[model samples]
Target chain A: MKKKKMIISSQTMELDVVRKVEALSGTSVRRCFQCGKCSAGCPMATFMEHPPNRIVRLLQLGQWQRILAGRSIWYCASCETCSTRCPNKVHLASIMDALRKLSWDAEGPSKESYVQLANRLFLENIRSYGRQYEMRLAAVFNVKSGQFLKDLMLGPKLISKGKLKMFHQKNRNMAEIEKIFSRIEEMRKKGEAL
Target chain B: MDKTLNYAYYPGCSLHASAGEYDLSTRELFNLLGVGLTEVPDWFCCGATPAHNVDELLSLSLCAKNLELAEQVDGDVAVACAACFSRLKFTQHTLLEDETKRRQVEKAIDAPARLDGKVKHLLEILARDIGLERLASAVSKPLSGVKVACYYGCLLTRPPDVPNLDCVEAPTIMERVVEAAGAETVPWSHRMECCGANFTLSRPGVVIQLSNAILDSAKSSGADCVVVACPLCHGNLDMRQKEIEGVYNAEYGLPVFYITQLLAVACGAGAEKSGLGALMVDPFPLLKVKNIL
Candidate 1:
């Protein structure tokens, strides 16, 4: 197995991430005691760079830079195990979500491969048509990720197996989908306006 | 006639496709049971796993559209697909539980869809609305001693609020439903384990391992067969059974059935009427052993 080398930078604070964290957390972030219970309970944290408890502490300590760059935010399964079990009821998932938005805004360390591809295909499909079409998303993701040549043989086999559908059912009102996206885009700009 | 509740039923992509049996059987059963499911007037995708993995707001907001439509009808929505039910349920759960974040999601989606009323899966409604006694009385054919392993995959039970129908670690709705159908529910591990859902495509090896664990666990528990409420779970366990067997160099020929299929049997509906044979793995032989046929 090959190990990939990377660099670590000194952490700093950014007000936007802090404000975002405070905005999402109903109770004060100060209530947390760094028990590591939340991270211990997270089912998906095994795949995370930093688990829920650490992310919360980062906010408590005002290490906003590291919080924004950690890839753990993207990998959370949103399972709510941590939130439901939290003693302080700090809503760790909600905090992670806000940090995720900050991470996307910062465009930090390379997004995990499958997570990035899946996100693009999913949003593009939703933006284009009102609903998801799995086959279409798989094709788009495969092509964009440059895996077309490797799985070239499996494509035809999948089609023959009836695993991949030939076409997708578009929503009856596509204009409505576009309008919804526009409204969301407008709101995103407004949120960023401040 | 109380027509108070209205919803946009986002049957996940598989509901109408390979899992059409689930799509059809659920529609029939729900109507018979008096739950009004007006297919969303205009619906979009739930973004499955990708949306949430890619962008939390994107997935939650996309799900909010379906919930928003339910709000337009001024009623709560119900989803049949396990993955769809879990995703939409999580969105509603997230919003209602956190006021500030909920506001952000509402803002992110640019729609103020009220997340009222429980987003129920078919099994929960049956177990709750159509009580076990009523279900038992309606059973024209008692499942008797048929051993069924009730498999609740990660989505339906985990993330607490998503299903919140029963214990996440040990869900009993499928067990209760199977009991109502006159079948014995077999207790086993891997009941809450992930079946690698959509990962069956991207990572078949992982899926094979997960599927094998489930099948082997059920077999060890003395289950003659397995029953599931989620079509995606059924597809993974049933369609991939052979692959799992091949990969493990073991024969685990357990038959998997949709809970509704077994209910149709208990209701005295013939297999033809219920489209039981349409499953990727035929369950007739198991039915024969139980004398259900």
Candidate 2:
């Protein structure tokens, strides 16, 4: 007798990641009857390849690969209309968020988008400083992403218009901020490895 | 007991820049109200529309860092800007819902703090905590008969729990505040409509269309002016009114104000002192016409 190997398709898995999403959001995912109301109410649903309702369905199946690989999850506006209107109160916005975390682990679509890259650098900068310094974030984002002069023209105009403040007003007890984020990051990595 | 409440405040990029008036007036008003809002020592962009448009988790982590810090404090974190409020609240909602995702966010953020639902907007604190009765008593000069259109915009109330200050759809915080200041808030359709927000840079035409809808709704409803709690709304409705007018071939210079500034004005804090002078489109004339000045 040959030994049997277990395989998981787009359908089967122990992927309770959806459960994690629902638990974290405090919304009842079990009650989602696939009414499509969440998708219908989202303002940015048209721009998404997978609408909020469908995304929730995908999460239920533990189709993590498709979700992490898909770009539609990134397009959610966090408008909360879907969650607001959901009869079952499935927080579609949060599930999309969970998928984004999966994407980070899989190193999926985040590579191509400079905006996403900028966001990482931006958060790291904030993690260090505890507040955002726009001028610095832009400069750092441009240098790292190799778009050194993307919005070069707007610098002087923004400064003159008093729109861009020069320096960050660093928060006191910044180490506390660093510590908090560090804890969350550690927890996230451990969860992903599981 | 003088429990000095403290929290990390994100002025959002716009509040520091285009809507400096909001930054100024909010801080001033908070100071007057005895709430200490220290800028989140060194915060990053909330990733508002940009990151959310590109990567979902990045946006969540971006907001989580701030939300995490807002939770670090005892009192609910107060955001002067509605965009920041919405993003922070949404991130809080997202993080608390999914345990694995929450762990992932915790990993991604890797900060030394923990969060527990303390994020909120200024309007919320004022209405729920401070109470409109107190806000009314603070009013020195009555803004009687000043017909105003209270614009809540999309970010403030849509998610319902994203630091919602009032009812999700037909929010009445602005109205209550206005009425507290002795002003009349007219009902209008485009109250919660998007003012193209940052999309104005990429999709000006869409914003122009939507802004026109908002302005037309207010104007048609006989509003003396539009009062908004968000800086972006003020930008589109007030500063960019000319662009909207050019597209539609009509005149619309409806005064848009930071709700706090209006509160200050109604409370007898002079317009200039309230940073009302900073508004790109002068609302003084409208105030004069409405006899509120």
Candidate 3:
């Protein structure tokens, strides 16, 4: 791993973005005294370039660009282990969500697109059908991610076990669901929500 | 006893589709136990991990709307999926604590956030509401000599305060419920570990690796099979068991059973009623070997 020299100065530090993260996550990055408990208990730490503690450290340093550009936030499974075990009461999992949301809102300079794609398809499924259509979600994910043959063998077995339904029934309250989506969009547009 | 417990059931989206067996067995088990379960009419997704992952407001609003819909039914909500259970509980917890988030969610859903309704997972319904003694009395066919690993996965209990199903690090609810049905619970590691969750879809290699550790722990602990409360856990553990075994060059033919399926079967529900046939890795071999079939 190449260690890049970090130049921390008034011009380089973006505390404004750090404050946005703090407000969004409802957790203070300054509260973390580098206890390393979050990283110690994090299950996805090995898969991430910046572990949970370092993500918080990076946030404290106002290096939001480095954090977002990496795949650490994308790889979080949101298991809440870090939040559960944190001695300082820092909600690392929620912080991960806040970071992901900000990155997602910016259309993400994130190196990890597969996770973003999966999240998009999942939300789209909710909007279109008002529920998840597993068969369609899997099929479309494979097609879009260009992993055409991924999990191909499991498909037949799943269908045979009747686990994968051939068709889906949209929820009866589709109009109500759509209204909620539009109202949230409207709220975001009006600066009423983050 | 206890004024006849009834709940507004929220099976979540997975239960209706890939986790259909969980839905079947929950209804069957509740029926056998003389509990009443009414589905929350027209309830949509609670915006599981993905919704919360990228859009917290949308997640909260979706769950808040579902909570409102659950209000139409006669009793507290009963959630089967662990992910849905966590999201619903987190929404209630957040709405009660954060005024701004609550106001935003209320406006997004076009209704006042309903935070008063209790969202209880099926495990809670069994372990706490129904009582372990009552659960034990209901089990006609005690699963003697069958060692089981009670896999909590991630959502049932975590983050100290949220979910509040049991002690976050050392939960015994699943074990207590299974023990009530006469199965011996094995002590094992990785019970509360994450199974890479939704990454099962986006990055299955992650699921394969993480779930493999869980299965290995269960196998080494002398657990004949693994039992779980969440459908996603079942998917990663059971559906991907063979693939994981192949990848690791191992031979853990452990059949993962849903907590409901195990209890329902012990309470004398037939195989079809318990949806045992739907399991990817066959459970009958172990069930029959233990004379549980």
Candidate 4:
């Protein structure tokens, strides 16, 4: 890869943004040389508005809004294909994760999409049951996302096969699970990244 | 090798719900093999896919709590679900590699993270712990002439270092296991392909597209059926095969079997005990044809 000739300027590099992404992901955006390996191996790249390579390029240029405005961040499935295939060892999956965390917080009420909605419902389910209660998660998600009847047809079949349980099962250490969440929330309130 | 080996089995949420068959088959297969698997007492979820993507600390902490529980058991944690395997291994990797994150997870779980070899997928136990030779000798009803496509899916071998079991891009552990049971595994390109597991619930179309491609690859390779270790992959490829055909406007009548189910069948256990009755894709006709039912 050849470096592009450009004059260096303080305004050209968003040092704080770069450092923040690095701190959270522990992967340097500067390590990416636009090799496109990450995007090349990404299965969901076609569905994404901006491919992972372009997102990394945007990150390198410190164009936070340009990267976040697109739905690409939400499209990542985090399969780790890119992370495994990267010769630069960039861990694009983790970077995508960091970006999603940032973008999710920045999302407005009207900005909710299916992936975002599912993610919120998923965490909420985990927070409550300590494990994914599939039927409950789906029903609550359907109610919240206003897709009440979505996947309704599949429920009875799943139930008949004993795949979906009617009653919720809680972990033995529900108090411990609750404490873990509270500890993380308490840390977040104190300005922690995670 | 010891006649009997023990493991702290950590069947994740799916085992109690959607993947009950997998849990049943795993226990049955292990029982016939003289392998003792003790379920970790009161084990919580391993934080699977969503937790890591949402909060790194919460993900690590969730996995750490399970690891702490497994530490009280006899052996390294043995998991059947690929997602739980990946998350738990990744948690151990993270807690070992980064001290600050380790401290954070330590604080969250109220337990010290033991990164010293406490997590392993069931495949590792079969292929490495219990030698393939032993498994082969134990097989009474060999699935001879049965052409199978061993699907590794994504999480079991990807990211190279997490589970760190087989070749990342092209895994062969599943093939070796099934092959030892006298089944012939066809060489296929989509072994480690992503089954769009995360999109199974939210976006059915994507799952259909990706899973169809995998099914197509397996079919073109002349596979009689498909074998999988991941519950979500099995769910997408088997439970939704009809919908997948509808979406792609093509037919792929592949019977997806959990590796343990097939292993149990090979080990002389009845199909019912292997949970074959619970499968969406009917394997009875095919198994009867092969005289392995």
Interface C-alpha root-mean-square deviation, candidates in order: 3.5, 4.8, 0.7, 1.3
Model 4, B126-162: lDDT tens per residue? 9999989999999999999899999998899889777
Docking class of 4: medium
Clash number for each model: 3, 41, 0, 0
Q: Against the true structure, what is each candidate's TM-score?
A: 0.81, 0.74, 0.98, 0.96
- Which one is best on lDDT? 3
* Chain B TM-score in each of the candidates: 0.91, 0.92, 0.98, 0.97
* Chain B TM-score of predicted candidate 1 relative to the true chain B: 0.91
Candidate number that wins on DockQ, 2 or 4:
4
User: What global local distance difference test value does model 1 have?
Assistant: 0.70
Q: Is the docking of candidate 3 incorrect, acceptable, medium or high quality?
A: high
DockQ-based CAPRI category assigned to the predicted complex of candidate 2: incorrect
> Per-prediction DockQ scores?
0.30, 0.22, 0.89, 0.67
lDDT-better candidate, 3 vs 4: 3
Model 1 spans > 4 angstroms off? A1-75, A148-163, A192-194, B1-10, B31-37, B71-76, B97-112, B160-163, B201-206, B272-275
Q: How do all the candidates rank in terms of DockQ, highest first?
A: 3, 4, 1, 2
lDDT of 3 by residue, A1-194 (tens): 78999788655667778778878888877788999998998889999999999999888887888999999999999999999888889998999999999999999899999999999999999999999999889999999999999999999989999999989868998999999999999998999888
**Cand. 4 Cα-lDDT:** 0.84
lDDT of 1 by residue, B1-293 (tens): 23643444657667755676776777666554555676766767776766665356667777887777655444456677887887888787767776655666676666686677557777876787667887787788888889989888767776554568788766777888888878898778778766766655454555677678889999999998888878768878987887678778987778888887778778877786566766656688888888889
Query: What C-alpha lDDT do the candidate models reach, one value each?
Result: 0.70, 0.69, 0.92, 0.84
The digit string of per-residue lDDT tens for model 3 on B161-232 reads 889999999999999999999999999998999998899999999999999999999999999999999999
TM-score (C-alpha, index-matched) for candidate 1: 0.81
Query: Could you list the CA RMSD of all candidates, in the order they appear?
Result: 4.9, 6.2, 1.5, 2.6
Q: In angstroms, give how far residue B227 of model 3 lies from its true place.
A: 0.5
